[model samples]
Target: MTAHGLVIGKFYPLHAGHLGLVRFAASESAALTVIVLGTVFESGSHERRADWLRAELAAAGAELGHVEVLAVRCDAPEEYGTEIAWVANVAIMRAALAAAGRPAPTAVFSSEPYGVELAARFGAEHRAYDVAREGHPISGTAIRADLAGRWSEVAPAARLDLATRVIVTGAESTGTTTLTTALVDHYRANGFAAMPVVPEYGRDFTYELHAETEERLGREVAMDDLVWLPEHFARIAERQNELEDAAAMACPLVIADTDAFATELWERRYLGATSDETHRFGTDRLPPRDVYLVTDHVGVPFFQDGWRDGEHIRADMNGWFVDELTRRDASWVLLRGAPEERLRYAVRLIDALWARNATFASPPWRSSPPSVE
Candidate 1:
């Protein structure tokens, strides 16, 4: 069937405001041409915006079969006047429709002032839908602002799937705990599920091996150098295995405070010079992490107690940990800057990765099980 009307806009996210226009056009026309204009611009990628718009329309109960979402590229001169720019856009839209073997639309739908003029140029019926009155209008400006923490609002149908697991690593007194807590808060506040690593080894082994030490050796010795010894490495490894197994069984998205690889770094640093056995035990142990995040030494002045090491060693150890993780062929993201700013950057990176993963609909082989002859 031929398209009865055409709708044009960037539709960066196709939120509730855009839904009103689509519903209005659907009532007047048998089929609507949802032309996604200026798709080739660098501001917002066409494929990214198109996918979001498609999902939004589908959720709004619009018929995918009758709704045509077209991505048209326009390259008009920068010095051109508004009238000339409109003419250029019209030419591009007409060509796009002709290439798709569809007739020109009878009416045009838009909420912008330019919509009326574009409709007149195409000799099509003009209809304006009020975006501000309808509800939340999803624009790039508003989305970016929300991300920057100016507002606590997000799109109702916003995709909150963070596919990658974030693993934070550092020795004690390096602000690892602070960073993990901050990340969890940031993600959870933004409507994503983030699980924190509880370090079962410290509690489990403490009760088993160090339980008696706490009574005999006292709190200072038990909490200090003894916990960093080679004998305790086995319990640490076991705890790490438990966490990894649980994460693998649970969800693909997780945030771990410290992984087994980081534990290995501690073993090498604390163990004596001739402790080859301890090094071998740590090397053979530990599971692979998807992405390892290392924090920089910006002199943030972290608190240190009797059990904690100096900032110099902590900073040096962080560098060695990153190098070792890299040598093991594990992907890593180095987080720098202030605590909140770093958290924001990490969240944005995770969001972008998740969005990319979502873009891949499905593979051909996965569509159906192996066909029998």
Candidate 2:
């Protein structure tokens, strides 16, 4: 019944210092569980912080089998203090372990002011590492400042990937697939790695819905019986995760055909209506992008694929795409022309992007790195 060690933190942007502490804890304990404090503030969501922590851990070789990442929501104002926060955190951890039917932890790992006091309450051994001299201590305040446009002072580890993974998004047959493929090829030919987004589960699920709900006289179609009124957003979320993981493994640039944002557009347009859940998901679930390539109406002919709507619907979808991009405050390049012409424009835009950007330094952990394949 001896439990593993626990490391609790907001980990707003898990940097080198946090990783060092985690590694220290892991070496000292039988196992290490990183408890990420969630819902601490309305500024950044729990999911975003958790994702950032997971990726940082992965980069630092701490995402091994022994380490577990868990999130606990702490929305109450009282949960921000030392003792109360520790009690709530311990209770949450116990519940989480019980739910998983695992042994309770025997130690708590941290370097914050409350480390010893918090450990005492659980009757667990406490280990404190000094964060002041550990690694590069780039705090959340500094990171937010950098993200607000002060890039020069940002730590190297805190910077985003120089060459971004951009997704070309739109409704069905809005040239997303075509543009994505062309961009990948263009980047590859120019001696850079650009991968098209692999179609995720939602596309397959949508295809299935089409096959079931509609009859194909000469083409595939979704049946009317299987409408979008009762669609679940879980499929979109699953796909988004898959895409993110794929991009992480990819080379300099990863181009996605469509993302969760595109799915939201379709759901709102075709489904009965959008709800608070859908809106929140759209607001939070979409990945942050360095740049967004939006294809405006280029008078391109709409292909009548099984899932595709008509020209009028396509135009309407374009408006929705613009609106969503505006809402997100994303800087975008509006590509307009025939499919091939649009492809050419995308290539030019990419050229501009690369010209203005610096080369990406190879991540320390990546071995046998991918080339433009």
Candidate 3:
């Protein structure tokens, strides 16, 4: 007879400690049934936690049949501690497992003393590990207290909220791309293996559209040509943020080339107007990043990239970027001076941020949107 193992929790923002329990269960049992019981009070989404578990378990060294993640929603686990309430909780877990074709677990694995009682409910053996938490030395409660301070404690698949995004924004001819690449290389070389470069979607989309026009009509199109259209901008801005969000989920530290806010400034340059639809789509529709480093067009060589509108447009756009960022009271750092100097400054800023976060004990995440500054 095989010991079918079971582990249950919110895995609420599953941390390293939870991983330890999962690893232990997988090793001891023939099959490990992970039941993620989520209430309305959990920090992360139930779906996200479930998805994170699936990704992790699939990657973990376990037989295909030995590990499984199941999401089962129930009453708030904290709302009651009565004996009957636990009986009810056990009933819900048992029903869901049975419905999914899992045998009542032969062993219940947990770090809490309640495991003894929980196992008794099913007449299963109580197997507890790390009840003292001496190895991992961290808890989900500690994570809730300081998400930034404990970012690495967050599991890989559930790490989007902990992501630190550094956006490089500037007008044409500026060193945005160069600085973005440098920063990405720096972050990756040190650690942060999943660092991503979210390139400007507007440019890519417009470039493709421009190319198609030239091929079809035999007349070349440019960036300014499409700026007057609100629909094009709105589409670009919305998708731009989506790309950032997706990248952040993987990296936990993203280096963006440009963002939707830059798209708005670009639109203002060519259309001689701003799009209300674009503004909201950029600001309201997406998760905001923590830092925006604006590169200066001056002290850098200017060259037309087949799509650029030259020095005059570049100058005007630079002013617009600064003016708008100020008017909106958005957080941003202006990078000037030599290329090497600029890169060093950016590196120092991020380096210092992480250094501070290393000791930071306050929570970085909240129920609402977080700011850059």
Candidate 4:
């Protein structure tokens, strides 16, 4: 008979220790189920945590085969060591398992003392691993208390979602790419090993479209020759968001030359109004952004890199960005002056953004007020 193993936790933010526990359980069972229990108070939703769990398991490259992830939401008061709370939690877990079509687990694995009773309630044997902090020496609480300091302890899958996303947007030849590269370099030099910059996907899309049009016409296609479509802008916006998300997974600091949100502005600039399809694929799908850096067109000569419009419309383009960003009440900084000067101010703004991201909101379970130093 095959033994089905179960591991459950809040995974407040999945960390290395949680991975270790799940890994150990997977090794011992024919099939394993990881339950990501969530609460209304948690910042990460149950589905999001499950995504993180799936990503980490998938990264193990078959070492964690036959493992499934599910989620259970429980908002009952977390009164530790109380019979009422334990019973309530257990009922929620059983209901979730049944709803998910999972069988009764033969073994329940956990690092908490509650594992004993949790297993008993399900008629499963309790298998405790690393009851002490010897193996990973980290907890969700500790990780939450100092998220940035313990960033390495966080599971690789969760890091991407938690990363600070900085997006740079501007009119043609306004140094958006220049500032993006500079900020990425600055972070890498400042010890951010995995700082990655997502290049503008719109340009890539435009190039492909231009090439395709030229091939069809059997002639060199001018920038105007490329016909823009609402669906085309939607694709660009969606891809831009995808690229940013993928780059964010590599490290905590992710810089994007442009993002899905920027795609909407580009759509309006070309089409006279933002299409429903573009808007749907743009800001609606954008990941939470820390700040938007708008590069100023002043003093920057347009290079007209063959794909770009002329300098005459550069101010108009910049104005669109400023107006839209202001209307949305989004956090943004206008970068101006020479490259070096622009970089200096950009660094200060990003430093503040990084500091703010590093500060984790206190979990709702903590009843006492935080001590002020």
Candidate 1, residue 223: CA error in Å? 25
lDDT of 1 by residue, 216-310 (tens): 66663544434556657655755765675465334334567776556566667767432444445445644434566677666567676544556
Candidate 2 runs further than 4 Å off = 1-163, 192-196, 200-202, 212-223, 352-373
1-373 in candidate 4: lDDT tens per residue? 2399999887768888898998899999999988887767666587888898898888897899789899778776665568887788778878888998989899999888768877898899999888886998988878777675677788877887788888899999999999999899998888686666699988888889988999999998788888999999999888887788777766677888988877898888888888887898766667878889999999997897777878998899899889888898889899889999999998898888777766655446655311100
Q: lDDT ranking from best to worst?
A: 4, 3, 2, 1
Measured by TM-score, the strongest candidate is 4
Consecutive 10-residue window with the lowest summed lDDT within model 2: 364-373
Q: List CA RMSD, all candidates.
A: 13.7, 12.1, 9.7, 5.9
Q: Name the Cα RMSD for model 2.
A: 12.1
Superposed Cα deviation of residue 302, candidate 2 (Å): 2.2
Candidate 4 or 3, higher lDDT: 4
lDDT of each residue in 1-373, candidate 3, tens digit only: 3479988877766788888888888889898888887655444456667887787777664454478788887652331347765777789889989989999989988887678878898889988888888978877767766665466677876675556777899888789988998888888888776666688888788777787777877876665654247778888888888888778766667788888888777667666666998888667765656778999988888988777778777777778788878887877898988888999999988877655533323222222211000
Provide the overall lDDT of each model, using Cα atoms, as 2-decimal numbers: 0.59, 0.60, 0.75, 0.82
Badly placed stretches (over 4 Å) of model 1 are 1-3, 39-41, 60-65, 77-82, 131-140, 144-146, 149-178, 182-331, 334-373
Question: Which candidate should be chosen as best, given lDDT against the real structure?
Answer: 4
1-373: candidate 2 lDDT, tens digit per residue? 2258878776544455566777778777777777766554434455655666566667667345477777666543333345664566567757766776656668877766567766787688777776464455454445433332333333223334333557687655667777887887877776554343556456678676666555544464444445564336546654664665456344445566666666667677767466555555556755455566777656766677554456777777888888878887877777777888888877776667654443222223223211100
